[model samples]
Target chain A: MDDATRVEVAASLLEAYRTRQPIEPLVEKYAGLELDDAYAIQQHQVQAWLGEGRVIQGHKVGLTSGAMQRQMGVDQPDYGVLRDDMFYPEDAPVPAGIFLAPRIEPEIAFVLSRDLTGPGVTVAEAAAAVDFVLPALEIIDSRIRDWKITILDTIADNASSGGVMLGSTPTRLSDVDLRLAGCNLYGNGALVATGAGGAVLGSPLLSLAWLANTVGRHGVTLRAGHVVLPGSVTPAQPVRPGDTWTAQFAGIGSVTARFGQETA
Target chain B: MAAHEAGHLLDPGATVGPIDLRTAYAVQAEGLALRLAAGERLVGWKIGYTSAAMRAQMRVDAPNFGPLTDRMLLAGGEPVSTALTQPRVEPEILLILGDDLPGGSDRDRVAHAVGEARGALEVVDSVWRDYRFRLEDNTADGSSAAHAVIGPLLPAGVDLAEVGVTLIGPDGERSEATGAAAFGHPLDALGWLADALAAQGSRLRAGDIVLTGGLTAAVPLPSGARIRADFAGAGEVSVRREAAVPPSRTPADTAETGT
Candidate 1:
């Protein structure tokens, strides 16, 4: 793809994200677009957000598990940058109008006390770098209309990352065996989905390590004090207005997000 | 611990896990001491993770530095062979000091102390498996120091605040960046390194060559790949990767190896 078109597509996606409007799949317009082109487009959008004063809070690893990858119709996982504006406080009302078609997935978030970089980072090394871990609910909303996305399309859409709500309680790694940390998602007090941390690439640490090493190849570092959201433990559940969801994790704590009525 | 692992091309395990920044640096110093005992001469230092984006990602308020040795310096315009586990290249400005500047030197003094600046490429290879590790792991691993190639040096007075850098590989993969990508100005990296060294009881001396942080993200260099970096005004440098050589068995190789 030519540089100008790349920039234009990125600008259009950025506009769609900012205005909370969904657009047609980019594959329809940019034929034979490769993964590199998708990432380039994503980077341009991220750069645009940075130019607009949006601070990078952290990053997210998406589609790490076999189920998520299968559900997403891709063989490999993808990553996305998280902005501070994308965060909603625990138990806070999530505005429905700000998203196109929102879905929620339970995840474990790692807060690092030191910088982590890789091309060769191991799971043990990644686990040892964690300052703490918390339960999180990731609200993923694809900018592509109807979410008809290929790997390239989703990657270009920032891995469908929309909003993140983090639990307040932080548990140290020594206090919890992440692989055994079971999680149950409840909507309006009714159980909807069940999973465990092991669902995320056998362990969330492995997922985090995978993200660190993959992004590190592109010259990105997972910094100290940064919060990294590993892939979902449970499949994403579609969110609707007036729906209140809670995710309880064993050993780790629980978090809740309430959706408000959509406003015009 | 890092020295032991790097010397043997081994991965960190029980002997050394992800450590705190302070412990990591201490381990790095110990590794450097071992290298010194083995007859490797320290030429200068290499500062890394200086860009705001990188620093922010690493959650570090400042950049980190590692020792540069004589053996790691490659001749300009030559084919460089590396046995590093996984290697990547970055374009940067090499600061060759003409005068001594200890810690606490101001910007003007730092500018005056520099003898010349050259376009350079640094080969960074992490010993940590999968290139994943904490700050201390990187610090202890000599900040992923592997090899460096220096270009023709330009006068110290050249305005480098906005020098453009473009790295191109034989396969036509390209990445472009500016000097500002390295801590706003490359000299700022020099100053940061000086201060950081001073805090650790070391000092930047004359004849030391400092490689400022990468202006662009590191690019993987496969065997037989020719890489060229063009630095606007400062000139250009190129290096071709030679075919890999099979590893020879050593005493360390026969010993207990950690993954």
Candidate 2:
């Protein structure tokens, strides 16, 4: 895609994210849209946000799990940038109107102490760089109308990232084999979904390592003190106003986020 | 605290004069707000005076703590500029927390919560002139922390209790120590920091970078110096003191290189 088209597409998506209004998919509007074009649009939007003084807290990997990839009909994982403003404190009430079509998924978050540069980063290297792991809830929102999105569309939309809520407890990587780490998601205090960390590219560390390498080729450095959110352990579940969601990780702790009443 | 951090010289009375550790931390929080307003992002916390000698010199039974920022981090392979005042360097171990550790967590728990252990170079630059200050004064000054360079990371299970660190300078000046110099084990210092932060109603969150106290005495950071810290098993991290340049690739460079 040309730079002008990338900028224009980014602007439209940014507007959708800002106003919580869904728009038509770019795949329909622009013919022959490739993953590279979609990522270009996403990068343009990220640059805009950075220019506006929003801090880049870290990055997130998406669609790494078989469930999500199968559901999306994609064979590979995608990534998105996490801004500081997108974080919701644990158990805080999240505003539903801030998202177009919000959904919740359970995941693990890795906090890095040492920078991880990729293309040759190994899962062991990624594991060694992790400072701690926590249970997290990723609130995914789609900017495409009716939640319809191809891999390219979602990638352009920053991998459907909306908000993240982190648990208070941290579990060391050595204490639990992340591949077997289990998660149980509760909505309104009822168990609604279940998954294991193995679902995320065999292990969440592998997913993180994959992301570090993929973005490293583009001159991005997963620096020390950055948070990396691996893809969801469970399938994304639709959410709405007045909903309270909690995700509990085996060996880790639990995190909760509540949705407030809908705004007009 | 704000006046002190802005480079304003003040009598101890005008700053953290005769304050207790609790009040000193409150002052530190206020100063941290000013830093955040000035666009400095908080990356992690640092434990100071973990060594008995330093604590005894400061006449304190416990250690002090401070915050770390993005601007204060000098990555390995990056050059350190002479933009800081009275900058000194120390070799230390960094504990990267993968979990949220509340105050009062046991050492074992702290160790279990750690995800990585790394060799580190801490650039300590006291905002206070001459580095002459009381414990409270240093506490309010962010523990004299200026910048840090994190070397390669090792898995948490690796025994860091006795890992050796060797600091080699551009002129071949060498300083060496072991992790045991940091409160017996680096995890102990981490546990102490967790408690300190917890006392302030904060916990060590996941992704928080905690710099254990200096393993060896600090030395002057001279310009044109290349400082490297070699961790016995964790690999090495180095920083060169030279000119500062933007690390980002220019569009022209990208176009030319086709990267």
Query: Model 2 misses residue B126 by how many Å?
Result: 76
In the range B50-120, model 1's lDDT, one tens digit per residue, is 86545554455667889998978987777664556567888888899999998887889999999888889
Which pairs clash in the backbone of model 2? Answer: A131-B96, A131-B97, A131-B98, A132-B97, A132-B98, A132-B99, A133-B98, A170-B99, A170-B100
TM-score against truth, every candidate:
0.50, 0.51
lDDT, candidates in the order shown: 0.81, 0.79
Q: For candidate 1, lDDT tens digit of each residue in A195-235?
A: 56766776789888998999999999999999999988767
Model 1 misplacement above 4 A:
B1-259
- Candidate 2 ranges beyond 4 A from true positions: B1-259
Backbone clashes in model 2: 9
Q: Put down candidate 2 lDDT per residue, B8-123, tens digits, no spaces.
A: 54556655468776677777888788788899889898888876535655555667889998877878867664556566777788888888888888878888788788888888
Candidate 2 residue-wise lDDT, A1-264, digit = tens: 788999999999999877778899889998978999999999999999999999999998988865467788887899999999999987568878888888998888999989999889998899899999988899988899987898999999998899999887888898876764556677897656555676678678889999999999999999898889998876789997999998766567788989999762
Calculate the i-RMS of every candidate, to one decimal place: 21.8, 19.0
lDDT: worst 10-residue window of model 1 chain B: B1-10
Alpha-carbon RMSD of each model: 20.5, 24.1
